[model samples]
Target: MCTAAEWDDFRATGTRRPVNFDADGFVHLSTRDQVHLPANRLFGGREDVVLLHLDPARLGAEIRWEPGVPTDPDSMLFPHLYGLLPADAVVAVTPYLPGPDGLFGTPPLP
Candidate 1:
């Protein structure tokens, strides 16, 4: 997920990637069951974000399973994309603004 402003910048550039992706050589993605926790942990109280529903088949990057934060259990692995995410890979874009008080709850998923 990314902020609304960040999305706008991505549209202009045709590529979407966070600073961490450049620093770490991969873009981070969380699973449906995992996103809420990380969202709260990393973006608590932030209301300007957007949820990007991606289609892995549309991805132009190389994705690899990698260990999550070293603090987590050693067996945990997450998908890391080795290149910028092209807009085409994003099948849907929904506003992820938090509700009042700037807190997020589990989002409805399909």
Candidate 2:
């Protein structure tokens, strides 16, 4: 539930760091690329539980968010990495899975 003002605040921080949540629920700042790759693969393809904060503008690109049925495990390909994203952050979503032939085709923004 991130509000526009809250998003503004985050951006105003003048930092492009990845926020980390520890096992104790404590949050800290880290580099965006510091996020582990395995975590990124975890959420490669998902349908249920709309993930917020997938900003195309931030990505400086256009993409599409095609919702698919949630698969088993209910986890993202790179859960740890993708989970670090802000709950309300907007991303350029593409309905594609990882591995060979990733992201089938280019996703155009709406």
Candidate 3:
């Protein structure tokens, strides 16, 4: 997930190197079921978050399944993109808002 402005820039440029990409060496991603973990951890109460639904087939082989933070379940492995994220690879985009409790919840699948 990313801020609305960031998403807009990504859509305009057709590709993006997320802020943490340089430090982390990959674009962080999550499955529908696990997205809330990172969203709540990183974005929390922010209302500017938006979820980008990407087409895995278009992502090629640079994707890797890797371990997330220690707080996550031991079996959970997040998807990390090792290259620029092409905007065309995003099939959909949706506003990701937090609840009144100031924490993100799992969104219904598209």
Q: Which candidate number would show the highest lDDT if scored against the true structure?
A: 3
* TM per prediction: 0.83, 0.24, 0.93
Residues 10-103, candidate 1, lDDT per residue (tens digit)? 8889888787876899888877656665677678889887888889988887999888886656887788888888887887888775668777
- How many clashes does each candidate structure show, in the order listed? 0, 21, 0
Candidate that would win on TM-score: 3
Candidate 2 lDDT, tens digit per residue, 1-110?
Answer: 12234445555763223433454232221122322232233433332211123443343322332222254234332112323334334442223233343322222232
lDDT (Cα, 0-100) at 38 in candidate 3 = 96
The predictions' CA RMSDs to the true structure, in order, are 2.1, 12.7, 1.1
Which parts of model 2 have CA positions greater than 4 angstroms off? 15-20, 24-78, 82-110
